[model samples]
Target: MTVSAWWFLLVGAIVTYGWRAAGVALSGRIDPNSALMRWVACVAYALLAGLIARLIVAPQGALGDTALWMRLSSAGVALLVYFIFRRSIVLGVTAGALWLMAVTTLAGG
Candidate 1:
């Protein structure tokens, strides 16, 4: 990239890091169990759930090529497996991704 591009990137990085440092400095003054913190956690989780749902229903890249039913089915199976196996998140995600890959391949789509 050009010098201007590098300068812009450097400035952006500093700004981002500044915000993080500000947060860290203020974090010590805030209670971990405060209502604001709880609300922030809930909002973050909601955003993540929304993003995942959007990807499964209307993906943008390679995942977009897979069938919706296939994606949903894999997710369902993953949840089932996770619950049945004492909530192993790694196993659940692995099974889910594998299931989606297998069914999508088998379906020829």
Candidate 2:
């Protein structure tokens, strides 16, 4: 790679690690059970839910090409797998992705 590309990569790594280092340094002082922490968690979950809803309702890129019913069915299957599997995120995501791919392929989407 070019020198500029290497420099950009180095800078990106430094910036990413800088935040992580700062988080680690401050983690000891932060109270996980505090009201502020609870609020942050709630906001995080809300943002995640909103993003998921948007993706299912009006996706972009290749996902937008698929039918709404296909997306909704995949999401339903994912949720069912998630709950049945004791809320395992990895399993839920894998199930959703596989279901979408299978449906898209079979339906020629």
Candidate 3:
């Protein structure tokens, strides 16, 4: 890989590991069921949802090749599967992936 790529990898690794370490260090002091922890969890989930929405609306790389309808349809099916399966991660992911593949296959691209 190029120097810039290596630098990014190194920086990413450091930051990821640092956050993990910080979480671990704070875990003992923080109550998992506390209001503050619940708020943090909500914020984390919101951030994740925002990122997913951004990706669907304006993706990059290979995902960008997929049509907006296909992406939205997949998300809708995934959500349906998740709720139908009582929030089963495996089934939701499988449903979404299969739906995307089926749509792409039917589109002939």
Candidate 4:
């Protein structure tokens, strides 16, 4: 990468860890159950949900090309399998990956 791009990466890393470092420095100084902490947790979850939504709805490359209904249905089946099988996250992820592969094959994509 160019020097400018390398500097951007370094700055991004510093900013990312700066937040963690600040949190760590403040940890125990503030109550974990405080409103600020809850709000931060909610924001974190919202970001996570947004990322998943984008992956499911907008995707990219090979994934973006998959049928939307098939993708949603595959996720649903995986979730069902996860709940029905004693809530095994590993099995759930595996089932989702397998489901997507099967759907892709069935769709001839």
| RMSD of each predicted structure | 4.1, 4.9, 3.2, 2.7
TM-score of each: 0.74, 0.63, 0.72, 0.81
Pairs of colliding residues, candidate 3: none
Give candidate 3's error at residue 39 in angstroms: 6.9
Model 3: per-residue Cα lDDT over 1-109, one tens digit each: 4477888989999998998998899987877899987998999999999998899888999989889999999989999999999999999989999999999899975
TM-score of 4: 0.81
Number of backbone collisions per candidate:
0, 0, 0, 0
Local lDDT at 55 for model 4:
93
Q: Determine which window of 10 residues in candidate 4 has minimal summed lDDT.
A: 1-10
Model 2 Cα lDDT, one tens digit per residue, 54-85: 98999999889999999999999899999999
Predict model 1's lDDT versus the native. Answer: 0.89
lDDT of 4: 0.90
| Number of the candidate with higher lDDT, 3 or 4 | 3
TM-score order of candidates, best first?
4, 1, 3, 2
lDDT of 3: 0.92
Candidate 1: list runs displaced more than 4 Å.
Answer: 1-19
